[model samples]
Target: MNPVHDHRRLGRELDLFDTDPLMGAGLPYWLPDGAVVRHVLEEYVREVERAAGYRHVYSPVLGKRELYEISGHWDHYSDDMFPPMRLGGGEGEEVVLRPSLCPHHALIYRSRSHSYRELPLRIAELGGMYRSELSGVLGGLTRVRSIQLNDAHIFCTLEQVVEEARAALGLIRRAYDDLGIRASRYRLSLPGDGDGKYVPEPELWRRATALLEEVLDGVEYESVEGEAAFYGPKIDVQITDPAGRESTLSTVQIDFHQPERFDLHYIGPDGGKHRPVMVHRSIIGSVERLVAHLVEAHGGAFPVWLAPVQLVVLPVGDGQEERAHDVVRRAEARGVRAELSGPGHGTLGARVRAARLVPYQAVIGEREADAGCAAVRLRDGRRPGAVPVDELLERIGARDSDRGTELWAAA
Candidate 1:
């Protein structure tokens, strides 16, 4: 019913990911081809987060309602959350599907008294979170009830806040650039009086917003008024799809109020207890939405780095099938996702056209195979003729590592 639905249709035609009535909607079943890309992207995010000085932590999918209440999320996030359940008899009788990974991480921090030296502690989680989305608004992976969020939270001292926020913004831009979505613009939202995601103290929220805005000032961003979460102000990155549709592809929100609400604090240099600021950010806000946006932006032809299948080796005849198998084996050995085009049968043109709907790199054939090469083709409609197998692999791998959209300079 929505243009987003049209995007979903393209996803199916390309064999990316899908949803169905049997699964009762909002539950996306990523096909094998789609999973490969999603899995790689998820891992890539994790690697970057770790390199950026964040520690990885795993937590439960469900938490007590009291937890949410204490964090202010229960009051604010209840409607969008899955229904709560009564825990027969627990320390605090409240259980709901985690809408976000913050409160849980905070609880982990409280597990032990933290000192000021550990003030700017960053925790990242690649989690599958569930929420209750109205069925009418659900469309494939874009707006789903169950989704994976590339979520991370940073608890830092006042002094470290600015640099931390700056680092997050950099990561956002780098990720987009890697995915070939560089033309996107970013928006920075600051808190107003009685506004921002509620910081327990007015001055704190005000000061935090100012600090973040100061760091973002030199950076190019469109400034917006009062669009931040109730707990803090934020920076959101958005891009336009082929039809000129704007979507917020990623976000980095800084929170000061929630941590204090949950009694989150660390011993400071003065040996006095002080509140730690919490930052809720997702470089890739929602993986499902990101995938959908990428699908539409590139019209379902992902780049080599992001493509599920990098190459499709097609044999000219049954005799060449052995060579094709060897070529495919070599490609896969080099971390390329390659497959034969229907074994001994199928026209190479038809297969290329079909695979074109997907993002693929090369197609090995009789001539190329005999010559120890593959017919290298770019998703951008360029046939670079037969390239040595090793050359093709190196080109594809290097482009992927460099986040280049194409094998040649234009890509």
Candidate 2:
């Protein structure tokens, strides 16, 4: 792998994001450019979830200590959690930043009684989660203390487990297909024997493992023992990056313990109350990590749709400045993320070099301005003569709408 294309280097070169000593390590703040990329990715994922029948919700980031205690995280995963803060006076309660969003979703499921018809209720949130990770292990976006998870929970009856799991896997596959990501392999992570961290119910563990196995049948996976989460068994989709390093990018977990521990239930067809199963899944894993992967994968040359600035308009001289600004306004009016750069800022060659990574660049010179058109330059070193303003708008808008990787071919 070329070090120049590494996410850390590209992040600096492109002014994507940064970490400061005063703000602490493992916590990154996104710059304006980085924020645009994040917003685009986030909105895309939200649309995917909406099509999958997920109801989005927002909950408080801090929860009472009793919440984790009841969910068993306080006893099993307290070390990964931040210290609880006491609120109010002597009889005040202690609340801590949430390490995960599962416990909160479970409470949402219980807020109102659900019937058998509402068997497969999916709740999703792109919420912030904090983990007290070791500073030594912290690096660029991949290992961070403050993270945003594309998390969701599906509450359904026992008979619906396989279907829900299949739907979740389909969602992951569709997302990866759209982004051109391929999973290297799949692993069925199971609990190990004599682990004090895991719940000690052998019957529950066996049933959950069996259900997951049924869900993953004929799906080409390796069964790995001792890698399951404390609450249940899971299927992890692993992807190998361009650097030959492997990481889990998506996961589907069948959790039977949490629903029981929290007494989550729904009315069945026979008019009897029955416990509902919960499936925890994340399609993109962490938003920060996904952005890092894409940065390295594309060498900071994002697809036209995902690029922070899809088009950069450069005025060749002072006389063309007004035309350049007008072109920018036209692009923006048509929903394109466009910016104007003047010759005052830098030489024409210098400005073009700086915007070399952008998918499309437009040079508005004297003749082109007089003719009301742009001399379009593509990232692939192709200048396709002067394109009329209306045609330029249509081509760029089509590429953005189609999420094409290259402007010339897309046009």
Error of 1 at 30 (Å): 1.1
lDDT of 1 by residue, 170-228 (tens): 89878887887764677877545542234456676677678777778777888777666
lDDT scores of the candidates, listed in order: 0.77, 0.89
**Segments of candidate 1 deviating more than 4 angstroms:** 1-5, 88-92, 190-201, 343-345, 357-367, 409-411
Ten-residue stretch with the least lDDT total in model 2? 402-411
- Clash pairs (backbone) in predicted model 2: none
- Tens digit of lDDT per residue, candidate 2, span 1-411? 689678987986798999899999999999999999999889989999999899999998999999999998898888889999989966799999999999999999999999989879999999999999998988899889999999999999899999999889989998877675678899999888834878887888899889889988889999998888889889999887678988888899999899999999999889999999999999999998888888888889888888899899999999999999999999999999999989987999999999988888999999999999899998889999898977888888998787765577633
**Candidate 1 RMSD to the real structure:** 3.1
Full-model lDDT, candidate 1: 0.77
The Cα error of candidate 1 at residue 244, in Å, is 2.9
What ranges in model 2 sit over 4 Å off? 89-91
Q: Give the count of colliding residue pairs in each prediction.
A: 7, 0
lDDT of 2 at 29: 94
